[model samples]
Target: MIRIGIVYMATGYYCRFWKEFYISCETFFCIDAEKGYEVFTDSIELLKMNIPNVSFHAIKDKGWIINVSSKSDFICSISERLRQNYDYIYYLNGNFRCLKSIYSTEILPEEQNGYFAALSFQHNRYKSPNEYHYDRNKNSHAYIPFGKGKRYYQASFYGGRTDELLKFSEWSRNMINKDISNGIIARYQDESYLNCYLQDSEPLVLSDAYGYSDFTHYQGEYKAELINKNQYLGTSLLHARSLLPVSQVKLQGNLGDQMFGFAFYCYLKKFWRDGQRKTILSLLPEGRRTTDSLYGVFPIDITDDIKIVEQQCKNLPEKKIIKVTEKFSSVFYQVEDFNAPVVVFDGKWQCYQYAEACEDELRESFQFSLTHLSEQSKEILNKIRSCKCSVSVHVPANTADSYNILLQKIISDNYFERAMEQMRISLQCEPIFFFFRDECPVEELWEELFLISQCKHHIITNNSFSWWGAWLGKNTEKLVIAPKNWSFWKDTPDLLPTEWIKLPINIDKKQLNNIIGQQILKSQVTENIGLYNGKMGYVLFFFHCARFLNNIWYEEYAEELLSEIYEGIHWDLSISFSSGLCGIGWGIEYLVHHGFVAGCTDDILSELDKKVMEIDIRRIEDKSLEHGLKGITCYVSSRISSPRDIVSTLPFDPSYLNELKEACLRLNIKMTQLTSINDILKGIKTYYMKLHKGAPLWCELYCVIDKIEKM
Candidate 1:
């Protein structure tokens, strides 16, 4: 019997691919070292455990293993196989897998009478000539002397008789060493050396079936078909190189970072190509007169919202204008007529400095009415209105150090508590308070402002959004409390109304309390909380809760609210919801459930579908889905004291639960019910089991559950 040895080394993400390959090979043939199918690797211990059927040999020689270049691994593996006196040795990349069984005699070079056996490279998928592989001007040792029309071979997979393979490895090593000595490494490095050596040796040629293209250029299913078709053609091995499907490969460390960077670059390139190309004319009146289109490069960072800027520009009339930018500096509200002598607004916060200047205009231009509230929003609003007084709080947790320090100072000075205490004393009743944290979206910020504008009083920080909210308030007798020092620099009195209270940044809590107590005793405050009764309010509240709690249920509820709102108006809500949920974590699930629920509109069935879809069927680490379920169960449990009340209100029919199971099976999500707090706790545990230890979401969910258990 002819002895065959396959040698490979996998260090990182390649380990995952290697496991698949080893399993596939074992399925086809008996991969035993004593039985001639010997495996060699640096990580023998890992391979031994993962592939128990295969006998592994550890490569102990440090001199032969080169970390900088993969080509060195190829040379080392071949050398080790030669020393072991194997009849035939195959040097395959860790990513190569055997799709079918093959005898050693079939791959051995009989007619060619040469050592190495490799398949000729296939046609380039990108429609470029093969000559693109080499630089003709470079005089490197590994540079192959290319003929006009000769086909090249991939060095990813190759096999040969022991002696011939040794000779080939030595030749490659010498060529690589020579190139290194001359300070000239070939572009393809080791593959270049192999090709150069092959030019002189003229080794046995296998069919293209042995080494087919499996890169991103090729479709996944089609590539899989091609790989399987090779098995039918009596070809055993298929080389995938490093281009394994993302679903199959679990990337780690620098490889994952590099892939993310590459993906980001691709995303940026696509964004640039598809981005709006309109030019904003920032013309100065005294500047040189020219008809030429002024081209200024706007450098965009990752944080910049290109879509928002594009949307803002859409409102302006399409024209170039010259204006004195210094006189009318704020372009956000003034750029109504682009052709007129007005400031040209590029989508930036600096432009929004004068957003307050045209508050009435902005309000009229945009839809901010509360005439169509959803059922859920109506409920939440009623809860908010139950209190005697309402106060909106804005805390910038994710802002710059200056703002964060300001927030810390306010917290330390007991500003928030003092304000709440004053409101309670002043109203002589329980106050309803809303906290706007850092992660709140811009749209939600506006909604919060709209809601706050309807409140009896407002306690805000040095935030522009809060300022806009206070300014937009319908309450003429509204008590607006703000920080004395609005910024790191001196306060700008013009930014706030003279009637507003400007308290010191670091106010003495005892002194302020006494002053606020006296003011409350003297003043006659008689304003009630306003309730939102519009679909917009409901939609806004749903999204706000979704983001704040990081829950998918609220997101889905928001989508459902939009669906209802659109159906009411006879408008297509799918288009708007699709665009809005594009980058959102639970977008895909929401869309899937939306379509499924829309098709099956029975209330009971829809509720079951929602619950089924809410479970992370993807089996991926989706924090949104986890937190969403947690938040939903938490909210439900808190609102309804009795489990029977929850079941009756959000009833889950037994028949529908079975249907939910079937739906979850189809969607691949593991469905669980929140029949009670116990069920929610069980789900938390199940999710915790799936999550890795010390993962941020894992810790967060653990803490949340732990708090609930205590409660």
Candidate 2:
């Protein structure tokens, strides 16, 4: 029998994948070979439960613990033993699974000029030379100049005769050590090291199918598959402890497109234990100047993240760009695969959970303050508040060029007629309707949208602007009716909330009634006990949700839940981007500086000011973004790392920010209400350096900004 040794490092979060890999290997791998499994893991107790043909190395030695702290370190430690013991040695990733019976002939190195040698599988994502993700940082040992690498080899699957593989392992350890001593990690970590070695030594470059990944859209059969295990384990703790990936995401498309992309980016951050604050590369079309579009619309500070690498996006020399797009309104890339270190996001990524994952941030970014509403708008809001039920119904005027008019016609008059009948029955009461006229004045945009957001419910012609209103609305149990199959080209994705009732264009009133759900059938009549703003707004929120979602049945048990909010002022309450606040007048600084309209009345701001003024922010003790004064201020401070626009800073004067800063003196926070391009660059570089220290490697990318003024 041909003796074979397969090493698997199943330490940390990867521990769960061990048995699956072992079983698949035993069942499908070369049956003729005498296979010996060498397991390197920290989970000895969990892995030792009735397994066979495997020797578990505890991985407890101080030498192993303090070394490279990567899979390569564990494999290198056993290279010598395996070399002396087995005829051939292979190091397989824990996530890799064997699918078909494979003889040693398929994987084992063949005689190359009378000597058995090493072999590696080509990376599935990068194929051509330019697309190869070779380290380009000229400062590192693994650095391969722009166009030198022959083939990009994935480090996940590779093996050879023990003597040859041991030599390869030692070479990798030396290169990694050198890179570490110089404080520069090769791009993609050990993968770059492997690619660097494979470039010169012409190993048998197998096809990409040998090491296929689940995310790869290719439908071809493969030997081993790379699958996700997050569904089976607690990823938060494991991912947090593992080596930080040198991954960077580059978003592509327009402002609206990026809004969805950024949300997905935020989702990736949460999934990988990396917050969305890290500067991501924003790749736009050539000649498009990167604009500070987040401005007041997003809950982001310019100084916080250094995203966008392309200096004007002119020199298009980026090695690899794995573009992700939607196919028939379906997600092109799995949400889980998005967490990988390097990927390009393009087109519309309307994954429902993408928004839900970062819903708090999204809400906070779009917050609109009471004072920010104009006098006319405030009146409209008051009316919305007074109504027992307010439902926004968006409709565009006849315009030949616009898509909305076309879609509106597609839904036709019958859709609205049915919607009206459905609304009446669902609410079980008369409900007011709001519209979105195509010719509405630009100046009235904020007021119009603010009025829409205040509404208890929404019905719409396909419109992104109005869709945002429903997204930012306050009612947890509110009704949102959208025309199903609104587009002509493809089946529309669930861009709206799943609970939001969807009616086919020609559906009968009876069909609509059936789809509206039982919860909506019951809760149309609100008591209107209090206005939906300020502290009292919270009570109404629970009351609203309690009627439909019985999760909070003990709603009446609270003792003075309103005590914490700024004295009994009416505030619009909704889910917000961050935890701090979502009421009309809440998170004032964040709302004003980020995106929410700050057009509030003096009474509202004055009352909120009193709450912060009364407390010594540091002494508040609650180190949370919601309750503590210090926490609230810190949350606001953390957002404005380096913003480049001042228009959103309007109405909420500099004096207001000063008062906030004065309230939290010496609290290690920066609330600079104004930011310059220089400030933006400096902040971005500072952020990059921090990542360089901890994560070390960065993909070569460029952020294109065409609209911003160059300093």
Cand. 1 TM to true fold: 0.29
Alpha-carbon TM-score of each model against the true structure:
0.29, 0.37
lDDT of 2 by residue, 121-170 (tens): 43433576766778887887788887687767776677787777777778
Per-residue accuracy of model 1 over 1-711 as CA lDDT, tens digit each: 666666565543344555676666556432343224345446745655644334555543221122223345455654764567577776666556666554455557764557678755445434443454653425677664445324455666776877777777767766666554443435555666666666656677755455445442333221111233234222211112211111001111121121222222232222223111122222222333221111111111221123323333333343422332223212222222121212232221222234334445444433354554445445656755664576777665654333244235423647667766666676655667876554544323334545655666788876655665565566666677877655432224345566777765543434423432332232223121100123433344345445544667756766765565444432121111111111111222232333322332233233323443344423423223244323323222222232233335543345544554454455445544323323333443445446532222212222232332233
lDDT of each: 0.43, 0.54
Model 2, position 492, has a per-residue lDDT of: 51
lDDT for residue 253 in candidate 2, whole number 0-100:
40
Q: Say what the RMSD of model 1 is.
A: 23.4
Itemize residue pairs with steric clashes in candidate 1.
372-534, 372-535, 373-533, 373-534, 373-535, 551-628, 552-628, 617-669
lDDT of predicted model 1: 0.43
* Residue 496 displacement in candidate 2 (angstroms): 3.4
